[model samples]
Target chain A: AQSVTQPDIHITVSEGASLELRCNYSYGATPYLFWYVQSPGQGLQLLLKYFSGDTLVQGIKGFEAEFKRSQSSFNLRKPSVHWSDAAEYFCAVAADNDMRFGAGTRLTVKP
Target chain B: EAGVAQSPRYKIIEKRQSVAFWCNPISGHATLYWYQQILGQGPKLLIQFQNNGVVDDSQLPKDRFSAERLKGVDSTLKIQPAKLEDSAVYLCASSLEPSPYNEQFFGPGTRLTVL
Candidate 1:
């Protein structure tokens, strides 16, 4: 079974500051990774996905994530996060045809 | 197009009561899923349906949980004699296919509080 781990439980950053959230996956084969964001009392929205092709994938809301095979990591990054980016982020890995999610990391933006 | 739709945004019931949730997946989607998310934890897949057929339901608690998709379009998840631990957010998602690589659209989810 594939599993994902999010090292950070919560991350705080000021508006306009850069942000990075770490994600690690345990899979035997080529992993299909994804990042998703969820606001308060809402369903999760897809951020980005890495299947093949480029190591870095861009998503909506100025979010991007890099898929590194050697380190088994796919970390999400934002050059300058906005106040609206404050939400819970989840990292997921595809196992067979099922997807497993991480515990998630909550992002807090300070003014 | 409209996204996935789920009914009963919030429900509060006492333990041992029964509850049900409805979900309407996006048109033409072949895969539907039900997940349970506890506070501070990620969503866990309880059951999956592929065109009205059961695909995966290994994690579902059969004794208390039951789900069905009629006509391969809409779904309903029911919990009988709900336990206190059943209090959580139940999310419904749909994808174009049974593959996980395909993008999945999520509904707003139904929050259940078992007192």
Candidate 2:
């Protein structure tokens, strides 16, 4: 079975600071990875995805993720985060036509 | 394009009671999914539908939970004799197809509280 792991339970960052959220996956075959963000009382929104071709994928809201097959990791990065960027982030992996998601990391932006 | 739609943004019922949730997928989408999200955890898929047929439902607790996507457009999930553990947000999502590469659009979700 495919699984996704997000190590950080919560992270507090100052506004305008760089941000990186770690994600790791366990799968036997090639994995399709994705990053999603959810604000309070809102639905999950797609930030980015990686299927193949190019390890780095840019997403909406000035976010990007790099898929490193060697380490089985796909980490999301943002050069500078705004206060609005504070939300819960989820990493997902697709396998056997089903998608599995990580526990999610809650981001807090200090203004 | 319109995103997925779900009704009853909030639901509260006593334990052992029954509840149901409705979802409308985006137009022209062939794949629909239902997920349960507990507080502090990511959403976990309960069932999936592809054009009015069940694609995957291994994680669904068939003993009390039942879902149907009739006519391949709208879906409904029902929980009979609910438990306290079943209190969570039920999210509905839709995709163009039943492939791993396709992106999924989600609805606001129905927050269920079992007292």
Model 1: per-residue Cα lDDT over A44-79, one tens digit each: 999999999999899999999999999999999999
Q: Per-model C-alpha lDDT, please?
A: 0.95, 0.95
Candidate 1: clashing pairs of residues:
none
Estimate the TM-score for candidate 2.
0.98
Off by over 4 Å in 1: none
Compared with the true structure, the alpha-carbon lDDT of candidate 2 equals: 0.95
Top DockQ model: 2
Model 2's CAPRI class? Answer: high
Residue-wise C-alpha lDDT for candidate 2, range B2-106, written one tens digit per residue: 888999999999999999999999999999999999998889999999999999999999999999988999999999989999999999999999898789999
Positional deviation of A101 in candidate 2, in angstroms? 0.4
- Cα deviation at B103, candidate 2, in Å, is 0.5
The candidate 1 chain B region of ten consecutive residues with least summed lDDT is B97-106
